[model samples]
Target: MTKRFLHITTLFVLMISVVLTGCGTEPAANDSGKLQVTATTGMIADLAQRVGGEHVEVSALMGPGIDPHLYKASQGDIQKLQQADIVLYNGLHLEGKMQEVFEQIGKQKPVVAVTDQFAESSLIASGVGGGTHDPHVWFDVKLWSGALDRIEAELIKNDAAHQADFEKNADAYREELAELDQYAREQLAQIPREGRVLVTAHDAFGYFGKAYDLEVVGLQGLSTDSEYGLKDVQNLVNLLVERKIKAVFVESSVPKKAIESVVKGAKAKGHDVKIGGELFSDAMGSAGTPEGTYPGMVRHNVDTIVKALK
Candidate 1:
């Protein structure tokens, strides 16, 4: 572990000690009688909101454009988790740095991973060793529907009185996801097979490529914490030139420099590859916007990819 992570862990332990001493019991529902749910990512937060409906007041720790892999919880974030009736995270090491914090808070209340319901066959291996699976399951619309079931189950378990309401909301939301899944399939099908390659700054879209039948290449590995060298850039440039690929996309959460370097390298190699558009990979767009919601984010990505590659 790096010095920063070690420092954060130390601070987290201290904070948790104080929180545990101050509160000996589970947090009660807010004045609105809604469960105070803390989710680690915007996608998971959206899931909690849709499934819990009026019974939940959801807060996302990692906001739009914030990369979860490198996110370290702050003392305030720890306080949020401590005060929450339940905590929800993407798990699968997506919030890698915050795992210890979650473990500590989990002892105090329900801490659930949205991807817990996924079978071994449903996950894609990161190939980074140690049997790690890719944590970006939300990219697959149908696969992400599993998260709805998990979240609804948790909400009902915590607030059993609202079981019927939660079930109703989940059914409605599932229909919307079914529609979004079909939209993604139809839209992404427009790209010709040869032009269906999606090159981005990182490997967060492996599930997306598998779901939509596109080939994905990333300059960086699964985590932005992973590094890339000059040779990696040259290799990607060569692939783009060889495949006659016209576009490369940058991610909102990751810096644009890496993809920019690839674009520069491609130009030098006589391949006119352009930065297709900014894609929401690890993060979503601003709150209150269409892209801020899960379905909107998926639609935006599908439209952007189709328009660029078609």
Candidate 2:
């Protein structure tokens, strides 16, 4: 989990050069007649593939365990966006560095924010200035299902001939989401109310907490771009000791050092706080792995939390 930042001037120059030069292979409309789709995250790519089925070729800009908060667009990503027939991303400023790039690309093709269908009132404000909403809304299966509507609509609009296939796929996927939500509720309910506290490296589980009745705490802020000072560590340590919370978690995309420090602090205060397990926050698990997909990630989180807290 390296926190790397790219210079804005460098990125701007690279993007402009690419846009002006028109380098790289221009995406042909017919690669077996598949609609060229590019998504910013794996979750969005998975949705596009599921809905578009054989009719679309989807590419994800960010892969497993890559923190989007610190992710910057590369020359290759810019080329992919230019070649794509449609682009989809999670908009709450989640892709912190790529916002300007997405805006610039929107002028050329259909650039869609999958979560834009959500009303402002439904979003949780990122208390850190600049008016950002928590981007990890997929943790709540119900809210995530809403994304299917956007994906389906975009696919149909772009390729009207595949409207029937897109609708059929979306309906099946929604049913799977409903089952996943039920599975989450049933599994999470087993943990005692007091043991439902979830402490992690960053504040990425607000939606999960609201949907599953857990209390979440993070050493850092909504975006992993923020730092956790000694004061932040001390406060969390104090809370863990006072509440006798059994476990805290590490995120797959964020560094585990903050979580480990909190555990050490609690031990000094005569409390034993164990590192529960790694949770998928900003990114999903590896491709072909169980946790690589959305449902698998959520189920793994629920099982891990239940075992550690209960």
Candidate 3:
């Protein structure tokens, strides 16, 4: 063959070899050069993973059932945050103890505070146990859809190549979350109006109750760290006695003792209040478990509440 022809033929073969060899199949766990992502909780981590797709390696500071409100970031956690390309956290003081650390990271990394992006008017006050916003947004799937969009925007900003993929996943996940909301409403519909009262260890489910037309009576405030005054516990127990409520729930993230106290007090007042199955309040189930996903977490809570109250 002529030299010119040979050179062109070689180049064409090389290009074809690269394509045929599946050179692009290893779809980049490091899409913008090994993006390290850290999320505050499992729910946020799951969203980050969906939005990041194969472009990012995501880690959550708070694992399933680990309360973000009281999470103390260890030395290793700091390193994760320091090295991460993007940091995702639910704002509104959901990570109460770790708030300052996350705030510090925001100055350096492409930190996206998901909850703060929502309207303040949408947040309900913690009522007597005063925190400005209720941060258990994942329980209310509609609210979480807004948060998911913010996460997608951040992922796109950090890794432009995955923008379309990120958007596609976001749209799909948003639809799923929307469906969860509808299902939640339907599941909750089974409960009678007076039986719709959800008394739990903390006020995390305020948004859930508001979204699903349930009455949420929380023993404590927004944070599990928020101490329940004697009067508050007494009032809850008294109410349970008077209302003839059968069950109260303890949170997986919060100590079970508190809810047990409520149960005991209710019994003393001539009422039978069982300690219902543990609910996911500030966090979710273990990483590999069904409740690790947003839909499963909310579904579990809805089913638990329905079984207890209905």
Compose the digit string of candidate 2's lDDT tens values, residues 1-310. Answer: 2333446635664674577357433444554788899998888888899999989999999998899988866777777887898999999988876766777677667889999999888788888667778898988899998888999999999999999999999999999999999999999999998888999999999999999899999899998888879999999999999999999999999988889999999999999999989989888899999898888888889899999998
Compared with the true structure, what per-residue lDDT tens digits does model 1 show for residues 131-248? Answer: 8899999999999999989999999999999999999999999999999999999999999989999999999999999998999999999999889999999999999999999999
**Model 3 weakest lDDT span, ten residues long:** 19-28
What value of lDDT does candidate 3 attain over all alpha carbons? Answer: 0.78
Ten contiguous residues minimizing lDDT sum, candidate 1: 21-30
Tens digits of per-residue lDDT for model 3 on 229-292?
A: 8899899999998888888898888888878888989888788889778898788888778888
Instruction: For each candidate in the order shown, give its overall lDDT on alpha carbons.
Output: 0.90, 0.87, 0.78
Which residue pairs show collisions in model 1?
none
Please report the TM-score between candidate 2 and the true structure. Answer: 0.94
Question: Which regions in candidate 3 have their CA more than 4 angstroms from the true location?
Answer: 1-32, 127-131
- 1 versus 2: better lDDT goes to: 1
Candidate 2 lDDT at 106 equals 73
Error of 1 at 24 (Å): 3.2
TM-score of each: 0.97, 0.94, 0.86
Best candidate, TM-score: 1
